[model samples]
Target chain A: MPELLILVPFTGALLCFLFPGHIRDVIGLLCAVLTFVASIILTGNIYQNGPIRLNLGGWKEPLGIGMCVDGLSVLFIFLTGIVGLLVSLYSVSFFSKANNQSLAKHFWPLWLFLWGSLNSIFFVSDIFNAYVVMELISISAAALAALSGTNASLIAALRYFLLAMAGSMAFLLGVGFLYAQTGTLDMYLLGAVTDGGPLMAMALGLMTVGLIMKTALFPFHFWLPPAHGEAPAPVSAVLSALVIKGSFYLLLRIWCTVFQDTTASPQTATLLGLLGLTGVIWGSYQAIIQNRLKLIIAYSSVGQVGYLFLLFPLVFITLDPAWKIEAWTACVFQTISHGLAKAALFLAAGNLIHATGTENLKSMRNIADRLPMTTFTLALAGVSLMGLPPSGGFVAKWMLLQSILASGQWWLAAAPILGGLLTAAYIFRILSQAFVSDDQISCCGHVSFVMEKSALLLAIFSILIGFRSKEVIFLLSEQVYFVIQGGIIP
Target chain B: MTTLLIYAFTSIILFSIGLFGLVSHPNLIRKIVSLNIMGGGAFLFLISLAYHGRSPDIDPVPQAMVLTGIVVTISATAFALCLTRRIREKTGQCLLEHCPDKPET
Candidate 1:
């Protein structure tokens, strides 16, 4: 199944590359749907059984490559599926309107290749393989960012490409150090051999820093807004919604498993949590001030990324199982909900920009009347962004609050609440402009139902996720081994 | 010092220089070159890790990984160079600076 997940999109990408025409989009959509179906089946199989483990070439754990699909991988795989399907649907409409058929040809191959790379990242258990997956994702993503051929996007892609390369090199170097010490690249094996030492600490530090740069955490988040904001809308949605999560997932995998015993000290975890706290405050403030709609959403990603980091401290500070489960649940929930809502927001924003032919929030006055569904999608996605009740964001926030209060870590608990308010403020900026009546609203193109429906469905899912907390929590916790606990240290 | 120590220190120095070049240089091409240098340092480090007391008894994993890393780095560098070229052709500037004259959309 894991092999199928990687093969389907990759093969589709090759087909698209060979046949770059109207047929490419159809092929791309078919591949994405097939991948999603395979992922769902994989998840169901994991549920019935424990975890699925595959040893490539029949080589055992420490000797050759192995892949594991635990609860975490299953959740992320599902996320890639949901977001991949919607983005593919949205892209078909998006690129058709673009009129540059040649660009569409380039887009299908790169996008599907990116989708394949993301699934590979989630499925691979070996750290070095993960590095390769990261590189593939970065290259494809950089190409996609430059697909629009605009000067702004081109520059952004250039900068993004450099940072991603540098970051991955640092990651590779860390992999070197770990291999030197443990003589293995499998994360689970590294857990057994690793001890608290300077080399391990240095390796952890280097890898964490590298992943942070790639993940765009706190001070390193400078490259994200430009890259995500300037890309074509569906591409922006993919980059913002799914690409960064790849590195974030890598960080989570490394910290919890490979570095479980030797790393994640109280001070280091708190330091990360502090950065997450700062990112929430800083990114939300930046989002509120942006005039362009996509920039605002991009900056909000920088903020929401902070929420994921908060889990590190909350999980590290307590030894209680309940606390760990709650923090883990909240963090994963936040990631999924954020991916759905942000993708919806970008697609809807893109449709609005298409209709009005301008990206400025001020110029977007009275667009709600013309594009009701798009506006409604924006509002629905905003509800999740603001952590409103009866939405996935609210559930994640509520769980996070419960965990923080349980641990009595009151200082950092305020970040999420304050971030929510800040999120509300920026979302209101767009929604308010939507209400005003403007006589000279210039619409440049027709908004397709395909585009609007895709955005709306993702937004609705983001909201509906709030109601599925029990099932999601069950799926995440049951029948799946937590790698940190299952590893040799414990 | 042992040969391993010497190689390790050389790789570290190379990495430091590459990181410094990356941070200090404003030109995109220079930055890309710096990235390649940093990647070279990592690859060197990985290869050195393969040296376990003798020539024939080296670790093959890091070698395989280094080989993969080199290919990945080349593709990224190639892509970055192409993007830099495109940016130069479009805007006539290699440095990524925000010109205050043009408004951001």
Candidate 2:
């Protein structure tokens, strides 16, 4: 099933490349749906049975490539499946327009390739494979960012590619250091054998820095806003929603499993939390000031990413197992909710751009009068982003606050609360434009029903998941045991 | 062991040089070349690790990984070069800073 998860999208990419015109669209959508189904089934299988591991070509681990699907990986896979499908749906109409025909030709293949690589990243069991898959993701994502073929986008893609390449090299070098220390490449094997020596510390530092760079955490996020903001809407949606999460997932996995015992000091985790806190404040502040709609959403991603890192400090500082799980689930919830809401926001921004023929937020004044559905979608997504009641973002932040307070780390709570206020400031800033009565609103293009509704579906899902948080919490705790207990799978 | 340490030190020096070049240079082609140099440094480190043990037969895993790494590096370099060409053709500029800001959509 894991193999199928990776194979289907790759096969679809190949087929999409072979076909042309409308045929590629059909193939792309079909493959997306298939991948989604496979992921659902895979998640169900893991839920029923324990976590499953697959050895490729009938070979054993340490010699053959291994793929593992646990609660954590399945959660991410489910996210990619959900967001990838909706974005693919949006792209169908997005590219069908007269002006986007050239971009459509390259979009399906690159997108499917990216989806395949994201799945592989989540499923990978070794550091070397993670490096390879990450490189694939960087290449495909950079290509997609440049699909608009504009000068700014090309420059953004180049910057993104160069930085990602440097990050990947650093990661590979870390893998070499780990192999030299443990004589094994498998994550679980290395974890069991590692003794928290100087070599292990060096490997951890190198790997963490590399993944942090790729994830675009604060202080290293220079490449993200342009690459995400300047890309076409659907492209921005996927890049913002999924690509950075790919690296974050790897970072979380390695810290939880491979480095769980080695050098996971409270000081190091607190250092991460500090950076994340800065990211939250800085990114939100930047978002509040951005004139372009997409750039606002892109910068917010930098802030939302900050929230994910708070989990490290909260979990690592508290010896209480319950709070550890609370912190863990909070981070995962934040990731999912942010993914959905941010994607919805970008897609709705795309619709606005399509309708008004501009990316500037000022041009959207009084847009609520003309495009009520899109305005509502943006507001609904904004509700989640603001961490309002009965939304996924609220649940995440609430739990995060609970864990922070429970751990007696009251100071750490400032980031979420302040970040939330800043988020509301920006979200309302956009929403207020809807109410302003501008007589000269220039809507030059049409937004297709499918495009608007797809964005709406994601926004609605972001809220709906808040109500059904039990299962996700259950799934996450099951894996938290495996992670915290230091049980190396044999 | 001494030989391994020497090779590892050389690889680190190469990596530092590449990183320096990458940060210091403004030319896109030069940046790409610097990235390849960084990859070379990493691959060299991995290759030297394959010879870490005194046994007659070397560990083949790092060698295999190096081979795969080379393939990935070539493709990325090729893609970067292609983008550079496209940027040159479209904007008549090779440096990232010189390219005009994208007009607001």
Q: Best TM-score goes to which candidate?
A: 2
Docking class of 2: medium
> What are the clashing pairs of model 1?
none
- Second chain of candidate 2: TM-score? 0.92
| Each model's backbone clash number | 0, 2
Query: Tens-digit lDDT track for model 1 on A1-490?
Result: 8999999999999999887577888899999999999999987787667677899889997777799888788888988899899999988888886454557888999999999999999988899998999999999999998887877788788788788888888888899888877778887778666576777888888899989998899999999998898888999999988999999999988887788745668898899999999999999999999999999999999999999999888887766767777887899899999999999999998998888877989888887877889999999999998899999999999999999888888888977899999999999999999988888866446898899999999999999989987877876777444443422112
lDDT of 1: 0.86
Residue pairs with backbone atoms closer than 3 Å in model 2 (clashes): A358-B105, A359-B105
Model 2, position A375: C-alpha lDDT score: 95
Model 2 chain A weakest 10-residue run by lDDT: A481-490
Candidate 1: residue A434 Cα off by (Å): 0.4
